[model samples]
Target: MQKQDTGKKLTVSLIVLALTVLAAIITRLTGLETTSAKLIGSFAAVFLLTGVVWRFPFRFYCMAFGFEVLAAVLGSALNLYHYLGFYDKFVHYTSGIVLAEGGLILIHALAGRRHTPAEPLLCRLFSMFFAIAGAGIWEIYEFTADNLLGINMQGDNTNTMGDIISGTLGALTWFGIHTLMHKRQQEKQ
Candidate 1:
């Protein structure tokens, strides 16, 4: 692949680094509550991860990093806002995250390289495998974060199932998206 003028990459990474540092400074100065601190910390992680993409353009990593940063920012916002008496509850956060994560996983899977691996049926299977596996690994991370850190990410068992199901739906959504993109690509040829 031709080397991209990743001065933009460096610039973006620097912006994230600055944001991470700024979040640290603002939190220290404001002396916010526990939730606020956690949220800021989440953003810090997001920025730091994004800042590292200067090394390579691995599509999965890039998408994962970007999605995760967004997830942290929005997730932390949900916790802080709801607890600060803005919303009635924090449950909405989990659902929104599940949907969003699923979408990200699908986008990631579709964007990845597809080597003509097998027959049409097998190709479909392989495609689904990557999408499902990617989404499932993310869910596994959520489980680990919940069980190990006491975060109640899944909420209820039923809700957890729903989230998993929704994630699969998100993968399906990506299939549609990728199909359209592939069609456009073929048309250009």
Candidate 2:
């Protein structure tokens, strides 16, 4: 059943990638030069990253990350962020959650069978730290792009601060849910 689900997810992800490619082509043909280039480059980067994630043993995490990337790219391509004021915040929050999941999966893989269940506190801390660090790096990238490429990736200091806060809150939210789920599972056992 899990394998079947994973297969279905992979198929959907592939379809999303195809659609993104089509959108990029359309954007290019329509003469939206800046948007076309940005869409194409973002799609390519996301596609390559998804490919790398696919190699990992954690199928679910890979799929989650792939979907998150696709959604982010789609939002950018369609100008959703411009139309919907909160769309950018949504993406940042989702990125934090997805990245935290990736961090947890990494820790799980490293722990191996010897540690069937790794230390919960350590896992939570690592995941939160990873999300926060990723958010910081992304801000740095936005700042650099805005200055060097003359793109306004970071609208203002308030926007930057809001993104960081949203990301951190997302990580904390994940931790809370994870703790609850773990406790529930323990109670069941």
Candidate 3:
């Protein structure tokens, strides 16, 4: 019975994931803006994965609700009107991608260290490396948009570096805080 239930859940999840992917493709192609497309995609992945995994309420909380909120908030940090610059009208999509990738690591740190929700400082630093690397790629994409695609992201090399710095700061801060909070809770218990 348990196996059958899991199978059914998996099937449903696949269907939902397909639908979500479809929506993302459509949005991206229709020129709905890249950042929006990314958030939509992230939401779909988290909700679908959580539903299919059949995790307990706590896991679901960490994976779906917590991660989604964190990703969105971190992503918004870079989209402020000031960063938008004049020509781009304050709309560039690469920031969201950088932030989303960082958020993913943060999610991993939370659930990845299930044995001790509080991973060591080294682990957090290690994850920060990946986050920073992903941010580098994101900057490249932004550069492509500005130079090749003629989108004028207003994010030249300096802007790209700034984005990377902010992304690293965001990821490291989130992870460090999470680890500290988790350890504190454990102590109380």
Candidate 4:
């Protein structure tokens, strides 16, 4: 199983790398140097994350890489965010879900290390807060980028608030679903 997972990881990593190169080409053709650079940087970050979480399930890496492709490639490089006003919100919502998953993974890892089961309530709280904190940190990044780099990453106050709200709602949705799943799993045991 581990060997199979390793092969799968290699395949997925190659696909992502190829997509990143394609996105870079498209952005470069459109003269969007900044967007191209950002996309490549995003790919690098995702690759690093894969190395860091190599022991985790492939699905988690897929989730993170999928977000990078959606947000960096399709959204920015393809300029989908500008054409589709809701795309940004959708991305933010997905980010929340991803962050929530990250939180769950972390909790599970810690529990395994301690040779104990994760507490249900603690897991839920961690997931929710991890997503919420991630949202906050993202907003801060946008703000800082906009202010320091003279880039309009955050748009106006309304857009920023909407992003935060959307992310929070996503986290809530994930929490509800995860709770139900956990309950079902426990009942089965």
- TM-scores across all candidates? 0.57, 0.80, 0.42, 0.85
Instruction: Find the candidate with the highest TM-score and give its number.
Output: 4
lDDT of 3 by residue, 1-189 (tens): 256655655555555455445545655576543476455655565566555445433333333333333333223222223333431221222333334444545656577768556445555555556666766776777777788878865456676666667666655665666579768988999
Question: Against the true structure, candidate 1 has what lDDT?
Answer: 0.51
Count of backbone collisions in candidate 1: 0
The residue pairs found clashing in candidate 1 are none
For model 1, where is the 10-residue window of minimal lDDT?
Answer: 86-95
The segments of candidate 4 whose C-alpha lies over 4 angstroms from its true place after superposition are 24-35, 42-46
Off by over 4 Å in 2: 1-9, 21-34, 57-71, 113-117
Clashing pairs in 2: none
- Check candidate 4 and list the clashing pairs: none
* Model 2 per-residue lDDT tens digits across residues 61-178: 4556555454545566655677678988888887788778877887887778566778987987898889888888999999999999998989999999999988888788878888
RMSD each, Å: 6.1, 3.5, 8.7, 2.6
Give the clashing residue pairs of candidate 3, or none: none
Model 4 per-residue lDDT at 130: 92
- Candidate with better lDDT, 1 vs 4: 4
lDDT tens digits by residue: candidate 1, 1-189: 225535555455565556555655655676644366665677667657655544544453445444544445433533343345422123223333333434444444454655433343334434554555655666688789999999776566665565556556555555555567667878999
TM-score of model number 1: 0.57
